[model samples]
Target: MEAVFLIIALALVLMVFAPVAPSDRARTPLRLRLARQLHLWDRYVYHDPQIWYPRD
Candidate 1:
């Protein structure tokens, strides 16, 4: 149970920093479907980080 919670928490953290924002170019039906699922998952289970982490 603890491991499951940790994995879920990690995914939520990653969602907050989604590497790319899907836009018009990603609007094709297939991509749209994928994006929709991801967005919904983010909405339900995501948590924004308390601090932004710098990237290279």
Candidate 2:
């Protein structure tokens, strides 16, 4: 029972400090590709198209 408790504590500690694995395509500091940047720009602009394209 003590060994099981210790194992669980070790696992919890490891999970707390585990280095993030490199499986995410959206990792930090990722440079935006041209198309992705354009799409992002579109989403941004489209999010409030009226702000940029006012219908005054």
How do the residues 1-56 of candidate 1 rate in per-residue lDDT, one tens digit apiece? 79987886687566555645456455345456556656876765455443244354
lDDT of 1: 0.60
Backbone collisions counted per model: 0, 0
The TM-score of predicted model 2 comes to 0.34
**CA lDDT of each prediction against the hidden true structure:** 0.60, 0.57
TM-score of 1: 0.36
Q: lDDT score of model 2?
A: 0.57
Best by TM-score: 1
With a 3 Å backbone cut-off (N, CA, C), the pairs that clash in candidate 1 are none
For model 1, state the Cα shift of residue 16 in Å: 1.0
> What value does the lDDT take at residue 45 in candidate 2?
57
